[model samples]
Target: MMENRNLFLAILLSIGVLGLWEYFYGAPQREKAQQIAEQQRIERGVDQNAAQGAAPGAQVPSNPAGAPTAPAVVANPGVTREQAIAETKRIPIDTPRLKGSIDLTGGRIDDIALKDYRETVEPNSPNIVLLTPPGGPQPFYAEYGWVGAAGTTAPLPGANTVWTQEGSGALTASTPITLSWNNGQGLTFKRTISVDVNYMFTVADRVENAGSAAVTLHPYALVSRHGRPHVSGYYILHEGLLGWLGDDGLQEIKYSTIEEEKSISHRAKEGWLGITDKYWATALVPPRGEEFTGRFSAVTNQVPIYQTDYLLNAREVAPGGSTEVKGELFAGAKEVRVINEYQNNLGIPRFELMIDWGWFYFLTKPMFWLIDFFFHLVGNFGVAILIVTVLVKLVFFPLANKSYESMSKMKKIQPELTAMRDRFKDDKVAQQKAMMDLYKKEKINPAAGCLPILIQIPVFFSLYKVIFITIEMRHAPFFGWIRDLSAPDPTTIFNLFGLIPYDPASLPVIGPFLMLGVWPLIMGVTMFLQMRLNPLPPDPTQAMLFTWMPVFFTFLLASFPAGLVIYWSWNNTLSILQQAAIMKRQGVKVELWDNIRGLFRRKPRTQE
Candidate 1:
């Protein structure tokens, strides 16, 4: 009982420390930083809706400092996406998992929509819009072009340069499209774009110089997002500009950070850089083993834009000479297995790092694969999670058996322990020594009960990270009323489990506190039953703490993902059953029913 009390106290202390730290330190710091950033943005005249008014066919204007610039022609207000697509000539993009168009002007691969995903879980919902063309309500696009040298007279492709399609068929995995432009100064440029069945687009740019003098130019690719997009503002997940620079590892910069710093530069021999949202990402991969400069910048203007760009070394084309550069763009969901395949087959460095797997990558990634394997076999993620929990329990069955057996022995010797404690009430050191002797004689480990719990801490945290960060868990359904595994359970007791007609989540202060869902209730019940496996603590304070722990945990886990809560409830039930069986086999009477009866039984009146 003392050991149990100590463990409970330790757990409570840790929780209190974390709660106080988050409320007193972390939340205030984040709020203050956000306020300062908002003030800075206002001082810079940053218009949040400036990107909505960008003109179609507007290329990133080159600034003297080499930062991205707003459109030369001001965008007309109230222009819709349909209007923007209609304003420019485009080549249709058809793929198994994507649908959109490639803008002919400036040869940008913009206007992309994810076919496999939707904006909502409802059937027939609109497909998720990943990228939109310039001048659209939200301008997010990827553009590849060349920059002319300081003294070169060659007219490189700019915002207004329109390319003529050299082919007749639409751009598909099997059919690539080639666009050509002639500067009329004896310089001919051709861009051939090819997309795979997935989201990768390969761009091959060739330059033929027929002029009398040699020309020097630099090829560059950029993934630019005009205006800041909506973010979940979660500290655990990163949603902004990020990239994998070879040997430099991963570089993640928030939009606000970019705005404050103006720009960030990284030199790499070969790498990929891009802008990342919570679910989708757009990255540009330069040619392998090629020296390049990557920059993440926020260009402040009428329509401020955040850009992830890279410029390769200059290539000189002499008279009647030609040069070609090959690069690739990844625009789609950040699927773990798909990214890993690209990293292995295509030699893309650290592509899997795109997902925020957190600090426990070793445990989190393997746990994801284990769950994924079962998901394939079971055909449902919810069922797979249950099976995974069972497997984990089975794996630690031996250790848990030992712990439970020790606990049963301790319970059987409760009378002897109490008597010893009374005899040594005035001698604390002697009591501990005698207790240790008794433990040795009984061949019992008083601390054994904590082993299983300690082992579960990392596994629990890793599973949470996997479920929260992986795209596969998005919109995944369990049985019913749980459409999205990444979200908390929808049904709350405050509305009588949806039998009533009110939303407690909308209330202030106490709203989130009242969100005790069905699964959390089930979990709390299981936890309470598990605690009943041992006799109730003798001390009044200890008994009260033990009784309230389950209720505390239930409310604490109410806001977690439904899938996680389900796992916890299932795991606790299994533990209770296993402990009961073990206690019976050890020839010890289980005190669970007696404890429950004691809870409701009327106490005999004292002779006052």
Candidate 2:
């Protein structure tokens, strides 16, 4: 009983330390982080009122004045996205990863949807819409054109201008589409649009001077998203305008900040700029090595409009001589591998930065690579997670072996420790001195047991961040009721594991508290069994604290991602097996079964 009390006290002290650390440090750190985030939002001018009133799928109307204005307030003539698409004569865009059309009216690359990804995990859910036509309910699209020099008599393509398709039939990866528009003043503008198997669209714009004189014009491309879209509001994720300007590194501007600042401008030798969502992004990559000015702006009228645009230096088109400008539009999923490929092969600078790897990039990226490697080997992400947990344990085995050995030694010396306490009951200083002497004599470090746990905290957080932010984990599934590993475990205990027809999550106040799922319960049980590997505390207070730790953790982790919970449970089980083996090698008796039986056994009553 005395040995049990010492072990229980040690565990209880560890729990108390962790609890106090979280309360005094972790809580305030989180609050400070939130405050910092709030300050950043304020600095960027995130206006709640403007965001609420912003119309979706709206675009800036063509300015007849030929002067650049805020794209948000420019009223699109179409009322609905479908109506806008129907109103225009378009060329169909069909590819393995994309399905949409090229609106011939202004030769805009709009009406795009990601063919491979859906809105929900359901098989029949609609594909995610990425780009929409102008004049639609949500006006988000990309357009390329030439800006004539001031006082030039050439007419450039505006929103109302209709361009005729040079060729017939649908545009495929093999066949490119060409659009031609001729101004009566003797300038012919031809745009050839081509797409690859993935999400890249190559646009080559050529201008011919049929007139007797030369004209100077600037080639420009703009991706405008009218109205503020919904954001996940997670601090770890960035949903806004992002780009790599030459030598400027990366620039990110939130929608609200655009509204507050009106516009952000930068001059780069060459680069790409665009608006990004949590999963998808649309960016305009100008010709490399060319000098251009990039701008991100927000305009408010009926709705807020966000636009990312770049204008190249003015070029002279001599009589009968044509000048061409080549650009690429990336409108698709933020797939890390695909983006990295583009960055390497196409020379798109810092393209992989689009995916938020967070501050722990060093750990998060390698962890993802390991998990991804195991996923391919196992053919299931759930199994991959389990395999990765075992691999992590193996890597830390050396350190953990020493820690567990120390714990075993401490457990064996618990009786001596308790006797020392009794021998010095009236002198606390003597008791501590005797305990230290015994510890040094036995070569035991009481703090060694916490080393493994201390190392695991960061690894655990990094894994959570990776699972939460990566697109591969978006709809990943495990066995049974775990369909989306990134999402919280679906099966809750309150409804008797789905035996009842009610959801506890719907109840007010208690809904979240009652959301304990199967995975969490399994995790709690593993933790409890792992703790029981050592002797229990003799003191009732310490024993009760140790007993309740697992329950507390089970409820706390119920809302975490299913994959994370699975990893925790598996890690706990592995630790239990490891400690048991160590304790046996140290000639210490395992007391787990004894402790389990102790719970059911009644204590004898003492005569008063």
Candidate 3:
């Protein structure tokens, strides 16, 4: 009974963790906001001084040293991304992993699509659009250029500035494009944008002091989104603006938080800032070894615009001397290896943080990497998960063995313990002391029974985090009828695995619970069997709890990722076998079969 109580406490701890996790991540907050009128939307620029009546405006950064400001937002009643792209003169960008174009009007990397990823698991599904031109449904793009220092109005390149591309070929991994704009003054701004085989884009801005009164200019880069992006409303994954500043550590500001505050600014020697989705991101890495002010700001209109930008320190371009500042932009799918490579090779500060590894970064990332390694070796992610689980069990085998051994010893002495309790029924303190004495004499640790359950909590959550957040698991397949491991199991028992062809999840109220899938059912059954391996608790409330927890979890976790459900079910099965083996070795009764039969057997009536 003590052992059962300890187990019960450990299970409750696990449940508490899961409940808290679900409470924050599983629910969305809906806020009521008024829509800005069409005229107001058109009038709203990045800042008050930003030009509002320009013909072709770009998404401008706020207080950009009074540089060429955003062109007035022309409100087209029904504007599509395609129409927005057509409006701009673009230099084609075609790479192995990415396909997009640079908007020549603003010299912004506006239109980008991930070539290796799709909007859906279907092969014919459209490529995942990462960046889009302005005035579209989701106006997202990265712009890099030079802004004049405080009092210098040098007719700097702004949204309306038309840059001249030096070469005609499409921008590829090997081919770099240079867009140059002249101020008709001394400064000639040339931005050469180059991309790697992966997602990193290197933008080197060179300013030529031709006319030559020494001038001061600040280099700036920004990622702008014209409308509020549809986020994956989960606390576990940050799907808004986040960055790692030099001294300030990491700052993650949600869209709503940013809107409320208007702007968050940090002056750092080195850092990166960006807007991130669950699977994709676009970031601005300021020039290395330079002090810059990074700001995340939003302008709330009917359709809000969010921006993350950095303005580097003033660079004094001497007469007849040129100044060059090189920065990088990461715009693509957040693949762990790729992000890590850029961080290690190019020395981007805390760039891997863009993936939102959560509080368990130490455990979660390694778990993901291990599973990924096994995936490469086995050629199947599901097989990799199983292999990793076995490895984890092996690694913790000694601890588990001792824990089970203690549990088996405790179980074997249950008769003596029960007798002791009955003998001391009138004195509760005496009962506890005698039990402690008995346990000490038997060399049994009552807390040892909870060890296995305690060990499971972090590992379980780490695996969940890896599966839920990693891009590698996004469309990974397991076996027949199990595709997209990151998504919930699609085969729901309520629909007889789709034989009925009616969507049970469409119903209201109980609709979500009704979508209980096959893997969750298997997990529930394994959980039930695992619990039945132990003797039913003598306390009726505890017994009832032990019996129904599996069902409760089944309903609760039916909507979890298929991979997590698979891991949980597999882990439970392994634990049962391990416990049974230990019990047999310790000369304790393996009551699993007896417990199963007892559930069906009828008890004779005592008194009529």
Candidate 4:
């Protein structure tokens, strides 16, 4: 009863603390992000600056910095506040490097990131524009470029040998440039180029022959990146213990470049050109006598690889013959889903891990698959976590039932054990022997309780591994209040003083306060309820062993995704219900009001 009262008080205090923290910490952080974005918009001249009227005969010109210069509207009709707000609300979030394209037969690369290019380089005419021909002469286009994402197109200095076309499906904009080619053999080919957001591009080829001459051409393609030549670097996310997908999908091949020694390549056996870092690239195939085919290579200033050798070579293409080679380029983040999609589209095998352990193969894989499926279904990581938790509970329900039954049997024998201990007060060994004999005579298996406890260790570790490394949890969100599953609960309600430290990036301080304060308290109370219903037999050794369960788990969960915590909290509540149901079935009486009164009334006993 005292325990119950203490638990209730703890819960109330926790709720109060959580509420205060949320008020103080959470709200301001989220507001800060919104504020930053708003400020960026204003800086971008999307707000008030856009509304100012221009002087008569003065036109706003495009700024060289790639920012739009607002054309002032003459004051004709007064605009209302609501109208301005609606206009502002229509602004879309800007996502860079939106899309790209390429024209194979026409030999034109359009929609280049000239704006991004200009930011990276100075406006100098000395920089060379290099383009590689399929088999013939190399053509050099003089650098006549100055353009920005926010700037108007720069006029070319010489005749238009090559240039970009502005359109939705232009070659240089969206990723994985798509192109087509036709040779004199009357064969036409269509190919799609996809680069990972990382800038690793892949080419998928499809060829159709109009004239049947049993034509076969070994495909080889090359595109030039101009600069003083130097050694490059490269790396592939392969399929292994953890990299199952990348390894199996890519064909093993080796290559020797004029710039470096021979090494293994993740690029397909037929050769695929790609660049990991770089803003602009050009392909110039100056007439290779109609049977032409080739590929292009992109270069960047800095390579994004942890290991040695960073280089992606140019791929080869053949006339009257076609093969699809996929290139994946990563720019923003090294996310697995985006990588997997591009790899799969290139007809690469899915990433798979090699774990031949029989039990792991039988159990862990199925469990992972189920978890993955649930992750896909709900989309919200927290909900997926809850589902996985429930599934795990259901799977272990039988073991728990057996353990509970053993505890019940132990409780029944407590009186008998006490009698034997009292009778042999001075002979501990003899008492234990007598107790064992009585147990054997009663046909009770003394080890029943031990099996469940023993099995939990490995199961716990396995589940821990799954939750910690599973890619599905990355960037996944929960419902209202909790946005990012990977991040901590945002509600920080109150401060040490009465003031609230608001974090606008997250929910109002209320979120963290409830999560940190109220949540722990709820957990404690639920734990108390669980203890009452499924009480463990009083054994110091078992108690010490079981203590590690919570301690180790709490430590392990400290770095775990918040989604997992939510699942665990819900799981604890469910466990309490299960135990309470079991206790009710065993005829245990639970008087709510009496329990509460007894808890408050009882005073702690002091040692004499």
Candidate 5:
């Protein structure tokens, strides 16, 4: 009994701490993150809510530890993204998946908006602007230029160097656009920028050496974002600079990490690097089979500037000869299919890692693949989740059955257990020994019940990873009231599902727990039903944990994505049915209804 109590207490404490942490810490962190995100949105829109391309899929590798030093950021105060867009002569980017423009001032693919996704679930909501211009409040833009080598006196095309558009029509997937710049030192640099039907941009730069002497220069590409964007704050999902560098494996550096380290440099023979938000990414893919240096850095002084850049080996441009280098840029949604396509078809090294598959890549990726496959068949992500939950139950059926069978035996021997307790009422240790002997004689494993929890933990975490990390799950809707499976259920019982005028989330102290959503309540009830399949633990503390666990999870999961809560609810319902069936087949009385009714029934006053 002591050992059993210790085990139950440990389990209760572990679960209680996790639940409490989510309520006390996770919820507040998310709220703080959301507030920061909202403030960023307003600041970004403070100047029309302003606005927001690629090179060919380039191959990989890096230079020396020398990364391009970031120039001091002079933020364009009071400048709207609209004004910035209008300020420059831009080459319009009108792809089927994207619609924006390429700023000709620096010849940077600075402006872009995803035509398919929106800021909100509303169909007519503003398009999700992925990149913005330099003058914008939260400036996120990509640049391609050459770094001057030792004894190189010729000027190169840079951020301040304005390039004139060579052709007329807008930059489409089929028709590439060319921008040319003259350095006056007889160096004629031309950049041919092209885009595929999707998010990949092909930037091929050619430098003609029409001068008298040879010039040595290093070709480099970088993605820069001025201000830190709001992160979801969930540790499961990485929201910062990340990429797969050759030999270096995968480098995931958070903004805070970069700030502390100043800059992280890597020399790779083949790889790519980029800055990523939860759903969106902008990665620089250097051409294949090349030696280059990749750097993830942060410059914080007036306005924080975070940059992910790569510098390639210097190319010697002989007199009257030309040198050309082609690089690829991925600037849009990190769709699994497209990212994999680029990874496989283009020979980019482990490019799919850009999606933040986490440490459980082996399981998480396959889980996503299964969920995606089912989604394609069902046409609704929520239905797909239900189907996957059922499939998971089936896969673990034999283990679950054995566990339930063991629980059934324990439940059947409850009368003997009660008699044993009364017989050894004075000696607690002797009572535990008798109970163990009975358990051995009946061939029942009391610890078998923990199997369900063990199975649920991994499945639960993996699903949460899929829902939070993948863009496909974003904005996916279920039936009534659950519009975005990626977001928490909108309707809360605290405000009577929003019938009341004020927000319960705005209240003090208990506000976070009050966010109990409908799906969470359903999940809690299902869990309660499942727990009642076996008799309550004889110990009061153990009994208390069993009784209150459902409520604890219900409150904790209210802040989780709706899809996860839905899965838990469906899984619990299945477990209840499965356990009840196992107990009935074993000729044991299932105490579900009796235990439930006993909770509410009045007890006769005890004679003192």
Candidate 6:
């Protein structure tokens, strides 16, 4: 018993020492890594400059001798002229030109006629923004507009547009602009842009046939960041259809896209539409048409699509009939609110947050929601986690109590099990069978020890899922010096040399180190106490092997989220207390050092 207590203390001391070391080393390394990343970014910029084919320190000439001169292919150049030329063929043959411009920089939502619009983005920009008459006297292309092969005329003629303010207080003159278009042959079109809404923007369009025959109109949408048009980002084709705009990001998930034949509209059922970029997404549904039906494409290839309650096809509009298409775009950081808002909009399906396969999310949503509800009541996520943890512990209390009670009963019978082992020393099988029989006679379930640990597996996984997906914890600071709960614990210690690869500044040498420091020590102490209190295994080597569990767990969790470790350590502490209570209730004296003597300090009796 003394040895067990001493082992617990020793383990705690070791963890504290490691924590101090980690704290001192974490920050500076992180700063060093950041510096390296910045350097690489600068180098990449320089490489791009070098690839532009301009003479060293000379300005690029405005015009080439004839067509633009292709840069000579340098060794190992991955980009090719054929690739660029092939991409051009994919551009919509009937692409339209810009027709109008709006400058709301002065805190006013005033419209500049389409005639005054200028091209702000290059033709090859990932997103193609075209402006043509929504519905006007004649189709006119604005400055920097080019005609495409389809001859559909960039903007359909005779379009009427309406613009109105949205939300309160002018935050850069917010507006919801709607444009109504009519093709003389009886094709009616309406497109709306909901913009400047707290970093979110949306564009939706609808088309209806008014003539006797059905007409086919191709539907296309392009989106990009306001200023950073070239950076590859994630986007959702539909509410749940998540995908990457570029190949730069792949989270090893499944997604879907629409077929090309479905891109053309002739008016059909009224349903959902969606698309995803590298990081964000958009979802919408269009109303039925009168004569012709339209198809809504939900394009993506990274995340699964959660189908909307609305129909997927536009309704067929009859002669002198119409259709309505509605859509909402969620543009923001990859936060939970962004995802939840998108899921709630227009009855779209929610994206299931996944981790370690789907098991964690599949098991934790109910528990997480419960935690969230209580969090709302108390107004604190941390406290909510604590409450949930307590609830979980209480729920398992009966089983745990039974297990400990059985364990105590087994400890009391250890002398008999050992005696059987000695009697059957030469026959291992007989020894094991005798023990099994003894357990059966004693009404003790040998497997009881596995119950608590088995239950912990799911609980641990669920907690991990919640921590990984919940945006409520993002940047939510805790008590003193612990900022940014979403990130690793920031405890820094400077190293004279770059020996350990971790950051130190933001992680300064306190928070992370202390977290790692105290929890593992507590875990080790609890584990030692538990080992001392429980019945020992028959095999001395096996028992020693089991004793390493705390050490292994500490190492495994060294860099995990600090909050999770805190919960685990607290849980272990509670378990220890529970076990101790069980022993006291049964009037089982631990007998500390005396128990150690009876167990380990005995010499084997030899008889010849």
For candidate 6, the 10 contiguous residues with the lowest summed lDDT are 137-146
lDDT, each prediction: 0.81, 0.80, 0.82, 0.37, 0.82, 0.42
Residue 521 of model 1: what lDDT?
A: 95
lDDT of 6 at 457: 66
For candidate 3, the per-residue lDDT at 323 reads: 86
The true-versus-predicted C-alpha distance at residue 100 of model 4, in Å, is 7.1
Residue 497 of model 1 has an lDDT of: 98
Task: For candidate 1, write residues 266-330 as lDDT tens digits.
Answer: 88997899999878899999999999888888865544578888888889999999999999999
Error of 4 at 397 (Å): 2.6
What lDDT does candidate 4 reach at residue 174? 44
For every candidate in turn, the CA RMSD to the true structure comes to 4.0, 5.9, 4.3, 16.4, 5.3, 13.8
Q: Across residues 1-608, which tens digit of lDDT does each residue of candidate 3 receive?
A: 46567756957775795675566544542221122233245445432334453343334346644322334453343578889889888899999999989989888888999999998899999999998876665577888777777777678887768999996899999989888988888778899999999998999999899875888888888888776655666677788898999999999999889878877789899889999989999999987898888888877654567788888878998888998999999999999999998889988889889888999899998999899999989999998999999999999999999999998898888888888878999999999999999989999998888888878889988999999899999999999878899998888898898999799988975776798899999999998998788766666566567667888889878888899899989999999999999999999888787787655545311111
Put down candidate 2 lDDT per residue, 226-338, tens digits, no spaces: 65776655566678899989888788787777878877778898679999998899999999999988888777654567888888888999998999999999999988789
Q: Is candidate 2 or candidate 5 better by lDDT?
A: 5
lDDT of 1: 0.81
TM per candidate:
0.91, 0.86, 0.91, 0.46, 0.91, 0.56
What digit string (tens of lDDT, one per residue) describes model 6 on residues 1-608?
A: 21233344445545654563344334434644564565456445535665786322211111111101111111112333233223221111110211223322111111222111212222332332221121111111111001112333333322112222233231222445554544467776665555432323344556666677643333322221110112111121112233221112212222222322212222233233333322333333332231212222222111111211112322444566665544433333334554555446534333322111234456676666876787789876666777788889999999988877876666667678768867998998998788888888988876676566667767876776566445455544545444544444444224322346654434555634333434445556666655555534444554555456556566546555556666676777788788778878877666444434444644311111
Quote model 2's TM-score.
Answer: 0.86
Candidate 4 global CA lDDT score: 0.37
